[model samples]
Target chain A: MPNGLDKPETTLEKIERMDRRIVFLAIAITIILPLIWPLGLPIGVSPQVDDFHEAIESIPDGSVVLFPNDYDPASKAELYPMTVAILHHFFKEDRNLKVIGLGLFPAGPPLLQKAFEEVAVDQYGAEYGKDFVNLGYKEGREIVMASMGESIPQTFPTDFFGTSIDSLPIMQGIKNYSDIAILVNVSAGYPGTKEWVQQVVSVFDVLMVSGTTGVSAPEYYPYYNSGQLAGMLEGLKGAAEYETLIEEQGIATSGMDAQSLGHLVIILFIIAGNVLFILNKRNKNRDRGGRF
Target chain B: MWELLGIWIQVFLTLAIFSFLYRDNPFYKFAEHLFVGVATGYWVVLQIRNVLIPNLFQPLFGEFSDPWLVIPLFLGLVLFMRLSDKYSYMSRWGMAAVVGIFSGLAIFGFGGGDLIIQIRSNVMPFIDTEAVQAFTQKAGVITFLNILSNPIFIIGVICVLFYFFFSTEHTGALGVVSKIGIYLLMISFGASYGNTVMARISLFIDRAQFGIVNWIPTVIIGILMIIAFVVLAITGKVDPKKQF
Candidate 1:
């Protein structure tokens, strides 16, 4: 009897023995290489992202917009760019944004602040407290949302900075959803885009838009189709599309080349992975006297 | 110069992180650890500022102060009590409070928002427009199918509810309907899984684009990663099946 390790390797053995880390590595390289030296692949704006832009653009200047940063660092890769692009549009158009954090994920507030500061808000003379106020993370997700729908000031007495909401110029007249022009929900998971739409938007009938991970996008499509959500930005592709739109208006087009290349590399890896699996499977089955 | 330097640092960090795609190695490990450390540090600071201070502390001292803050603060303190072996049982109170609050919130939210509204929305007529409604009414086939589907929808709801019944044995027509209900549930889950896979694949694609851009330094980093993979493979330091 031969030891298990010393036994002659079969095709099935090789197939089964294939390393998943290698696949991860392949995927990593495929993504990174493109980011570094982008192929500058052409990307078209999806209607979802386009509609989201149109909705925001239609909102009058100085209009109070409820902007929820309903995500964390885990989803930063996808949502961050979208956040920047949207903030550019809002700030450029001179719209007042009331940023809210629904997620208890502590990283949500500063991430939004950093993105806003980096993405043209500084140049556009966007001031905090006057132009925007971070409401921070409110405890009791759905309860707080319901409370917010009833009364914004009662739910969040102060902004994230511990400053009184009553003192903020932007938040002065904003009592509820009725007061806001539109809702821009950038969400990752639970207590996110869906929660806002269901708990607040549905009853208030507020015009709402969203930017969510690709995973969450399809679930929101029914709402979009139903006209409950005016528009949506779906994942990084949606972010890139929105970025492209912004850049065309001369905001952040340079980044799109990088974004497009990154997407292309990933598509290539998926193709490579599927090809390898098919090849490996065929070889194994042939050896096993099974038809491919 | 500093701004350009910051951009380069970002580019390097991005490259370092992406190096993991080729293989698990020291470079990837270093980057991963650095990210985890920085992220955790950032989170801890934010939690202190946002959740711990405002929700937990200010409520204790601020004008609208409440004694109830003590209850949550005590419960939260009990969570740290878990670090001590002798006081591990104390942590259960905190856990219970959290679980209870979350469960109550889920039921309340889901009942009012998801369950009621989804059903209401689906059952409601699609077209309120007179032209569309008149056309649909004139189309006898549409009216017949719509009428036939009403009972089917009711039957589906009953069957699905019955499928969850534990105390009683499903029998006769109920048993058949329950089985069909299980199949439908499974199909729904499978479709959800398919959608999730598609989303994850899109995410992976986004990451890959970072590495493949025309920048010279980035192209060099990509080459280095490949070389490192080959070196590790040649040295037999990594067993692909086990490591991956």
Candidate 2:
């Protein structure tokens, strides 16, 4: 193997010799720097995101929305922004909400509270048991989801902080999906948006919207096109775009600049990586008698 | 004072998790473990209050008590048998119940929502008056191509479904159609991959900005990291060839 300052190294030599730490550092910088000093780039809202916005927007005030936060902290980086944006839209539109969680992950309950509290502070003088209720996490994902759509209180008798559902103004007349206007699911993986669509939405004839991780987005496109899901927020980019729309409406727009620039920096890094890879391949092929 | 302390704890914990970007170390491990522990504890408490108490216990003992609750309660308890080797097989009943319920729900859901409804939605548009009216209005070179291509939509759907039909051999005209379907599927998959890469890269960019722009102190940390690597290399603590 040739050392640095010697003849160009073989691909195998580079792989064997390159420091793993360098790759780690590159990834770290690629993620962190843009977050700190954002470029505030423009992001066009996709039709999917717009559909999500319109679904929630079209629901009348005082209508019930069953929101399931089915993700943990690991996914917070991507899903949190979407949660905030959606909640802001919900609150701004004055919709009554019933929050439930399928105990897929432990962090889900508290994360839901934190996100709601962050957005609900300034809008509508929102009172806890009256405007919304957190039914907390339930076991048995499919069974619970199916039962809840049939009977809300049968699934959750009490709220998260130990309040009876009967006492909450929000639960007064909301019997099932028939009373509820829409089902908003902010999910990470299994027993998530897909499960909700299958077990609850399809059976009950409820409107459904989902915000899912990037990896899961493609799988859901068929459902989206079929009208099973009225709208979808696709990963962080979708979240960021949704955030932009919310902020433009004069809600939590303060963070848009930071989010936009972060996206631009990532796009630049991908371009740089591909360019370097192609150049290196060409140089190696030329030296190796035209063999790629 | 408590609020300030909480803020500090959160910030430090966030930084500790982020420190894994430099290298895997004790701080990162500690944060990871703590996160898992706290998260698990939170879920257990929530389940007791919302699920176990209300759905199972309340119905078993409270006003609306029913014998049906006992069945699920027993099954739920049997899941604990998983902890003992002798009783491990008992847990399968609970597992089978959950799997059976999920599978039934998934099949019904997919058939009603995805398969039937999707095909209906796509085909319904073609039969509508709007489509025919547009075809009639534009009856020229462009419109002729559009009208002629209408059948291709149904053909494309059939071809794509046929391409996945491993049970049958491709022969005659079906072979060419299936080949086209395979090409379309590949292009769609490639585009999806590009979207996924873009999403992951955005996450990477966000983290990079945090390390560099959040604090100037990271510069010194960066320098220390480089120096440590160089020293390890010089002192033979790390083999140059095995750096990865």
Candidate 3:
């Protein structure tokens, strides 16, 4: 039998065996071009985000809004903008809401603090101790959450900076789930929205809204359907939709063009891959007796 | 100036990491190692500052030390014993306490929230009378598709569950149902994959914008990377093991 390498490489073979760098370069160009010149493509808002907005808006004035910024640096690209946008809504709204950023995971606290600095302080001139307090990362996942159900200050003795929660003006009168009006959860992975949903929301009957990473978004659908979650945001597209709803175009909004075009490129590659795979399969079958 | 400097450093790191797509090279290796070291150092400091010092040390040894805190302090020490192979067995006490507490907490949470609430919700109202009325009256522009959602949802849930029921062989009519279940699962998986792609692309867009807006530094470094890569390839210095 002739060696496969000795045979001339076909067009199908060339395309199939093409350098991975070409694929990467193609995706890179598609993404980069759109960043330079945005297409301004229209995007529709999903019902989940609508519910999320309404849930936030429905919070009574002076109610304590406890939001867990539960994302690591790896998820910052997707979840950080959502955190900033939500912070903007909380600070800008005339609700007199005491929005506290709680960090259940270690990576969550800094992102929350960064969002606060970027949106609440830099843009809206909101004070830290008065307007918001970042109850930085604690070890216990479910127990810590259950503890918060009892007492917020006890669960988180100190804020992110290690100042006592007792000292912070933001923690004044915010004792537990009963004191808190809403839970807006931003999650990347485990010990995240699900834990909060079970430990906090279900335990206390506390109304909640969640923004989760794309891969984990479907896990929350049942929660949303069950009315356990008042609203949900599924990833970057969800973030972009939220930006549109707020009418404040930021990074998420501008990135939509690239997001769309990049997806298109990926789809094209998928189609090409399927076609090449079919061709290869047919050739093998022809080489055989065309029997299964 | 510091802000700009920080952005430049981030850009350099991003480029260095992305260089791995070309081939495993010095820059990629350096960036990877640096990331591991820096992240470890940062996490260690954070744990000491935010957790250990505040939660354990201060509570036990601060001016108004709590005598009751010794129990936890001892347990924490037991956990540290895991570092030594001889004393690793002692770490189980701490591990047991952790697992027990979390399990106890999680059981309650899952029981009241997920098990009950989710099971009850699965009994979806196939057709809501109020929804039908609304659609008929055109009160909210509700479509028939809206009404069909619950039925489709219930069917999907049942089919997916059936697919997991390995006790029954997937044959004949059951095979058809199983096939449907698999199709639904694939569709769901496809959607999840699509969302993941969107997330990755979004990150790429953000970084691309950063590089474009800071073209001055990016261009200089990018060109240097290309030159170095070419020179190495010409000299046959490119590591064959690293190449795909």
What candidate 3 gets wrong by more than 4 Å, as runs, is A1-6, A287-292, B83-87, B138-142, B239-242
Q: Please give the lDDT score for candidate 1.
A: 0.69
Comparing candidate 1 with candidate 3, which one achieves the higher lDDT? 3
Candidate ordering by lDDT (highest first): 3, 2, 1
Candidate 2 chain A weakest lDDT stretch, 10 residues:
A248-257
Q: For candidate 2, write residues A165-280 as lDDT tens digits.
A: 88887788877778878889988887788878877777888899999877678888878977889999987778877877776332123334544544455566567667767777
Candidate 2 lDDT tens digits, B28-50: 77889998898678777776776
Candidate 3 C-alpha lDDT tens digits along B20-80: 8888888899999998999889888888888778777787788456678788878878998
Better of 2 and 3 by lDDT: 3
The CA lDDT at A211 in model 1 is: 90
lDDT of 2: 0.70
Which portions of model 2 show Cα errors greater than 4 Å? A2-38, A93-105, A246-292, B1-23, B58-67, B81-92, B122-159, B167-179, B201-244
lDDT of 2 at A40: 52
Off by over 4 Å in 1: A1-47, A50-61, A95-104, A138-140, A150-166, A176-178, A202-205, A225-228, A243-292, B1-16, B62-68, B78-96, B124-243
Per-residue alpha-carbon lDDT of model 1 for A175-260, expressed as tens digits? 88788888898988877877777777776778899998877777887677556788998876777788788773321233455444
lDDT of 3 at B147: 75
